[model samples]
Structures are given as structure tokens and as C-alpha cells.
Target: MRNVVLGVANTVAAIGFVLFASIVWSAALPLAIGLFLGSLLGPRIVRRAPQTALRRGIALAGLGLAVYLAVEAYG
Candidate 1:
């Protein structure tokens, strides 16, 4: 029962992430880069740490930098 509940929760979260990414994808390039970098850096920044605030900040910074670079390179 517990496993089933957890699985459902995970599925819901995954769907939400996909939907959010799809919305960002509509912006074309910059947002796609931001999302990609966020997925890559966000985990490392937040891993095995109890500091939620710092993790969020680092993830946001990474996302911003990725978007900026993408726009500068392609735009």
C-alpha cells in the first residue's frame, strides 16, 4: 500500500514536471536551455544537504546562466 501511494505520487510529480517543461518549451530556445541546466545542476546543488534555501538559489542561478548563454549564442 505504501509503495503504491509513493508510486502514484512519483508519477504525479513527473507529469507535473513534464507539463511545466512543455510550457517553458513554448518559449523556443532559452527556456529549453534553462530547463536542461536546471535538471543537471539542481540535483548536484541540492544533493545530500539539509539547506533548502541555498540549493534553490544555486539551481535558479544555474538556470539563469544557461538561459543567458543560450540566448547569447543563438539569438
Candidate 2:
């Protein structure tokens, strides 16, 4: 989980840097603030959550999304 988070963070940082000139500050500023706040608080919240339960919930959600997409595509 830690590796996955780090991988995505690094990739997003690179992409944002490359597109720095094209980003609309008006639209991105509010979102950037929200994300900054979430980054500060999310780890504290996750530390208190049950690991097994979190894993189960995530697996179920992935499975549900896969099933939904499959049905939508084949129906």
C-alpha cells in the first residue's frame, strides 16, 4: 500500500511539473488546497482504520467495479 501510494505520488508530481504552464490556476487552486488538507489528515485517519477490513472493502469494491464494467460492455 505504501509503495502504491508513493508510485502514484511520484507519477503525478512529474506530470504536474511538465504541465505547469498549461494548468488553470483559478480551477486548480481550490482543488490543490483540498488535496493538501487531505494529505495532512488522511494518514491520521487511516492509521486508526482496521487493516483487514480496509483490505476486504477495497477488494470487494474492485470486484464490483469489474463486474459492473463487464456487464455494461457485454449487454
Judging by TM-score against the true structure, name the best candidate.
2
User: Candidate 2, which ten residues in sequence have the lowest lDDT sum?
Assistant: 16-25
CA deviation > 4 Å runs, candidate 1: 1-50
* RMSD to true structure for each model, in Å: 9.7, 5.8
Candidate with the greatest lDDT versus the true structure: 2
lDDT of 2 by residue, 1-75 (tens): 999999899999969876775766687889889989999988997899899998898899999999999999999
TM-score to native of every candidate shown: 0.34, 0.47
lDDT per residue for candidate 1 within 1-75, as digits (tens), equals 999999899999878987776555556578769989998997896775678787787799999999999999999
Give me the displacement of residue 40 in model 1, in angstroms: 27
Off by over 4 Å in 2: 1-41
lDDT of 2 at 73: 100
Error of 2 at 3 (Å): 12
